[model samples]
Target: MDKLISEFDRALRTVFAPAASVRPHPDAQIDEPAMDIADKRHAAGLMRVNHCGEVCAQALYQGQALTARDPAAREALRSAAHEEVEHLAWTERRLQELGSHKSVLNPLWYAGSLAIGVTAGLVGDRWNLGFLAETERQVSAHLDAHLSKLPQADEKSRAIVRQMHADETAHAETAVALGAAPLPLPVRLAMRSMSKVMTGLSYRL
Candidate 1:
């Protein structure tokens, strides 16, 4: 009953909570790139996809946390969820700046991701961490691709992406340290392919 209530509370927060991005490292150095209008549009599209990823992150962590048997693993899921909130906040802020709205199917995305998270957790602890590590690793690579594609004049977005990329890298490292078993090559490839499809579709859809 407590777990059910907790899940319900998390769902409510995810749906109704208002968040403004909070920089944990207020003094961190940010480097901005310059990009033209064309590039900015492309960057915005890419950022939209990234924002969707963060939404999924929230649902993923919540679902995993709900089922995690290990206290430490549950705490880790919660910690990651907190960081995901910042990512969600920042991406929403950036989307507004770019004159864009979030994915029309955000609720769908969250539901699907939550299902994936819970399933991963039920499978095993190592698999759960493996999913997380795979996710962050893929996200980091996607950010790198965005860095290459973003407009040279769009310094603000670039700065945000750079910081996000760095943080994601750190997250992956932590997951590895937490005994994340590496996923098989085929699973990794399939994940990459799905991500590509998502980015391609969400860029304009």
Candidate 2:
């Protein structure tokens, strides 16, 4: 019952509350450049996708934390979740600065990610860590793509993406250091396929 409530609270906070980061946002100091309509639209689209990604991250980490049987693993998952909340808040603030709104399907994304996280957790701690590492690896790759695609003049967005990429890379490395087992090739491919679908749809929606 406690876990259920905790999960419910996390969902509510993620879906409705204004996120507050523990650390300062990377783009907080950078002034928003006067972007051309095309650049602004493209930047906004990418940031929206990023914001949605953080939402899914929150769900995934929270779900995994709930099911983690080992105290050390649970703490690790919760710590990662805390960092993801900061990322979410930063992206959300960036979206508003860009004159954009979040993805309309955010709740659906959260639900789906939470289900996946729970399933991975049920398989055991090593698999749970493996899933997280893979997720972060894929996110880092996409952030790289977004960095390449961002407008040259959009320094603020670029700063945020760079910091996020670094953080995700570190997270993946941490998972590996914690003895994460490598997932099977088929599972990895399926994860990538799901990510592709989410990214393609989230770019516009």
Candidate 3:
């Protein structure tokens, strides 16, 4: 019951509350570039997508941790979730700086991702880790795309994305080291399709 309550509280905080980061903001030292209105709006849209992605990540990790059978696996998921919270904070700050709001569909994104995470966890540890590893790999690729799309002068967003990319790569490697089995091609394709839908809607809505 206590764990359930904690998870509920975490969900509320993740979706509604301002996120706090332990690490310094990735763009703390970079000067805010003077972007024109169009660039600012474009940057905000990309950051909004990134922010929604982090929200999904938090839910996915929590769900995986909730059902992970192995103690080590649970701990790993929890640790990754913790770092994702920091990502949330960084992206939230960047959004504010760009004068943009987070996606209105964040709650929907979180709920759907939580369900997927739980399903992955129930499939057994090897597959659970595989799901996580694949998630991180896809996220890294998404971030790379964002890096290319962001305005040339918008170094703040780029810095955050770069750090996030590095962290996600490391997470994927960790999962592989922990005995993650490679997911079949069909499953991988399905994941990518869902990601495309999320990113496409999140960019505007």
Listed per model in order, the count of residue pairs whose N, CA or C atoms clash below 3 Å is 7, 0, 0
Best by lDDT: 3
State the TM-score for model 3: 0.99
Report the C-alpha lDDT of model 3 over 150-192, residue by residue, as the tens digit: 9999999999999999999999998999999999999999999
Off by over 4 Å in 1: 15-17, 24-37
lDDT of 2 by residue, 122-187 (tens): 889999998889999999999999999999999999999999999999889988988788999999
True-vs-predicted CA distance for residue 161, candidate 2, Å: 0.7
- Cα RMSD, model 3: 0.6
How are the candidates ranked when ordered by lDDT, highest leading?
Answer: 3, 2, 1
Candidate 2, superposed: residue stretches over 4 Å from native? none
Off by over 4 Å in 3: none
**Lowest-sum lDDT 10-residue window in model 2:** 66-75
Identify the superior model by TM-score, candidate 1 or candidate 2. Answer: 2
